[model samples]
Target chain A: MESMEADILIVGGGAAGFACALEAAERGATVLVLEKQPETGGSSAMSGGCLAFAGTEMQREQGIEDSAELLANDLKQLGGTDADPALIAAFATHQLETYDWLKAHGQVFSPALEASSGQSVPRVHTVDPADMVRLLAARCRTTGKVTLLVETAARRLQHDPAAHRVTGVLAEGRDGPIDIRARNGVVLASGGFSRNPDLVRQFAPDCEHAVFVGGAGNVGDGLRMAWALGADLRDMAQIKGTFGKHPTDELNNHSCLCVYKGAIAVNQDGRRFVDESLSYKLLGAACLRQPYGAAFQILDEPILRSGDNEVRILDFERRLEEGLFIQADTLEGLARQIEVPEEMLTKTVADYNAYVDSGEDREFGRKHLVHNHGALRRIETAPFYAYPSTAAVYGTYCGLRVDPAMHVIDVFGERIEGLLAAGEVVGGFHGNAYMTGSALGKALVFGRIAARTALGAAAG
Target chain B: MQVVVLLAGVVDPKWRLDRLGLRPGTELADESGLPRRLSPFDEAALETALKLRDADPAVRVTAVLPGDVGSDALLRGVAAFRPDRAFRFDTSGLAPWDPRAAVRLLGLAVGAACGCPDLVLMGREFGDCDDGVLPAALAEAQGWRFCGLAHAVAIADGRFVAHRIRGPREELLRLPPPALVSITNDRGNRLRHPLMKNVMLAKRGPVEVVTPQAGAIPRAVVARSLAVVPPPQRGAGACRILSGPVDAQVAELAAYLRARRQAAAP
Candidate 1:
């Protein structure tokens, strides 16, 4: 076995791992990032690239009123009693600085902000997810203090029993077994277990039929490794699929959230089920309960024209070009195309339009487009469209329990010294429902915090 | 029966190649740091070989890949399929653009990595650099019978049979031992996922490395320069929707169709 040493050993080279490495290197600490896949960016690259941040210059420049308090309050309101308030507070505290840190380190965000899920207002700052990871990885390499080894998978954590601390990691490199010692600590940021069917079945059996799409390397490596050491898990039962993925589209991993852009979701019976203004996570559960576990987002030319190509979920025209959206000149034609009753669909459209005019939704009581943002619009434009949608488990959004500093907590609620975690691997952040962009947001926030805590512990 | 599969992984097609250029002072394309996976054709060839092994317990399969350190992961991925032997031959200082030289080196690597085999398999294009020519060129140079675009391979009457499609027609060609088949991707030959246990074992196991003796072979062709060009833009016209009652819209659409037909009539 070949042995090496670094100040901090970060597992999984996605957003969290790269963020940790970049932060550690900037602080003059030697970091080694091990990525199991051939590529560095894991599920973070495949993500929709929205980061939820509050009180940022981008939001202020757009004249959108937002603050960290509002962001935290919204998270708790959506999360209900299951959310960990400490973790939410930690996120709200560091989110602004992290946003500045990313922008200072060359992370580019689009000018447009989208309102989805739990946002009180539009706060999603978007970037090309792959480019963001690549940028961080490149910066890490340039620091001369971070060594990133792709194709090296961390197999087991080396623990010092006498010291009660994690000392190193046993990894399998391209050549053979490699024993790498971390002088400071080890950060587990290996993403979620959506790709692991057995784990998904055990945790979320109802989500078995949901399409599994994420980083191919995410097979619960971090969660399982941490579980071996008696790490207490959090929010595992709250694992719900995200709505709006085209179940049969294999070429593209992105999901079209037409509902967020003023489209109404209709079941196979051509009737609206849910309010369509709730969190997509809640909508996902409702969608799964529908016939064939599928629904169609019905919209019009005006709603379709409101899409922004820069945002992956709102890229309606691109999906149109891919032939994923069914378009017709009339509701009757759309009803025939999507195989719904013409009279029911026409009546449904008429009813929805009447609700928009009367300022009241009698059926589902949908008052806004998505979450409390964007007024409801009448779906009466000339060209009508239908996007076939189903739920997809993009991330498990649940994993091991960790403190605000990202230290792994054991079943007994004691800190597992020198064992830290971040990213999707650390749960308790999103609680019962996920707000759009918060998963990626918490990954970046917690990753930098994990690095700081590790180095800060060593200094103390 | 001894079967050898020549696998050359390609850069993942899903990734956009922002930059493509030759390495400094070398004719080879600078592809370091780019992610690669087994191409569809390569997967078909390996799956075909696996199918043959599954049918006969006595059949021994060897998977050989020619690449640099970056390709080791691809070989490990093949090893997860649990072939009798899987190894990578050092492809440094070799130019894949030079077909004759590439064939010569590939032939030598195949011979050195695995002994004389009853059958050999490779992808249609061999690698991203070739234009569906290296497999046939190798067959011609080695005096072995060759079949191109084979979707599946099986033994029929003690001879290797290649199932392929040629010009929209399916054809099955039977060849004697020591024949080479260039496999093409198809639903029938889609690669199966390896067991997680086997994948873990393969990751931990040491990879077998082979360095083929690249003798001074004269190159018949030389690449002067290469340029990466973006694909042509496809401009889609805005959609025009015909509204109002059905009959009037149908009549207007029929008239437009008739005008187009008249304009197209020569």
Candidate 2:
């Protein structure tokens, strides 16, 4: 029956948790990060490493002009009216400053600006998420005020019903059970419930069939704990998977996103299905509704070569090296190699190529390569390639609801006292549709805000 | 009974090998930036020791890490498993390639951590570079009975019993205390996730870091070498699959290989 106390107890040592700990410790608060996994870095480490930030230095250097207003408009348009306008506005306002904040705290980003699933312009800045988490965790350790506890999972939030406050936590450790008193407040940055099949089945049943690709530690512990406190949840039914995950290749975390770079998606009947130009999250939903929930990314040689080998989802050449791509001299041969009907695939490609030549996607009307940019190309080449692709639940993208100040809101429409949240565990930022890189972005922006609020600082 | 497990392993082997780089001016690998985690066998040995601790009320599991001392992030990283006592026998921040050198250093480290431990457990290969060298060399140096490739180790009749896979069958052997056993990963002996509460508490105090005096180097007969192996060139040609039954496909594959081998028998 060991017990300890800290000024702040941050559950889940993920991108959000680590960022919160660093911010709180810098402000001279004793912060403790409890992670259930053997190591930290949650799903953030396994992500595609893209962060959506408007008006970034990388964007300007790359000669692409972007603004917060435009970025906010894209998110709202893509996410529909379901997304919290207040939260999206807050994110737009702080997105640029957060990018600078991360850089000021030893975070580095690649200069290359690449287009991802949903973006009007190239703004997805990349980083080695694992290295970034390691760097942040290293900084947290150096603070002498932050204690990181991996292999320690928070079981439940200790709520003082009379005081209407979450005072502490009941957690299980390496040895046995222990209680921790969060003197100031407890922050839940425990990530999403994508890894928990039961929770996924309960909330977003459509995602149940998607390959569960998420942080092993994310099993809805924070979600359940918050639910026990009557915390209102948001966007639960909107959990959509990331498209183009190699149906059988579970080892690699990143999915192949050739569809975003002018590749077409074909269903089991060797016919094109949904418009692949939409957000990948939307594509995942459309893909699942197809036959057997499986499809293939059919592209030309130029499109195959357009892949950036460094980034995971963008690295089509790596997948080619790994033998994930079925290459053939003719589309018929590729269709046969992938065990699909040759005639149907050949005709499908011919019609698509004709449409590409005519400058219009007649049937699906896929105008842009991704979202609304990058012109589509004709799939006419000697050596055609086809990759069997499906969808995977990368992150739940839904969880407890929180306010702009990062306070967890209850079902009664009141803020839960001494309870704050950040990361994938606190959702509603991405409503019905998810734009790539925004999950990590939201985690960072809200993580700092949560720390500032918990430390009694004015919400910046 | 005090049991000591070697809690060291190779860098996560799952990393894309294309990312690996070799240091210039030295044959050493540039794995300092790589993510290092407990190997499967390392977890197995640690799990086996925990099982022993559970089976016997008096048994205590201690960990002896014979690698980096400066890597407090990694050092305290493994200590979260909540061993009874754990410490590092500081090396040059890397495990030496010499088998005998690793043995001498590990022997001193074991002695320093737990005086005359009843059993010493280690992975089948320490960092893959050791290749069962550490356990064999240590047992030889200490003159203790050695057992290698044991998937499961248990205490029975006051003796250490090990069930090992030999060829296609399982073999069991029993040895007296003060035994050194090299363990391989087993389905049942996976390391359990440590509770979050204990992980925080276990790493509170400073990890006992000791720098053992360098042992005498043996007469050198071994010189290690390193080379990058290029992948075999795969012919970029049409792959034709024999559309038939399984037996027919196997026969065709066998005939093709036989014909190719005979044609190349120059």
Tens-place lDDT per residue, model 2, B28-57, is 566666666778888899989988886786
Q: Which stretches of candidate 2 lie over 4 Å from their true place?
A: A457-460, B1-266
lDDT of 1: 0.88
Task: Put down candidate 1 lDDT per residue, B1-266, tens digits, no spaces.
Answer: 98989998988778877778877787777777787788888988998999898788788999999888888887888898899999998887667877888888788877975567789999898878889999999989988899999998999888999998889899999999889999998877877555333554688899988886556456887776778677676667545678743435778899989998999999
lDDT of 2 at B62: 88
In candidate 1, the second chain superimposes onto the true chain B with a TM-score of 0.83
Computed on C-alphas against the true complex, the DockQ of each candidate is 0.02, 0.01
Clash-forming residue pairs, model 1: none
Looking at model 1 chain A, report the run of 10 residues with the lowest lDDT sum: A246-255
| TM-score of chain B in each prediction | 0.83, 0.78
RMSD of 1: 18.9
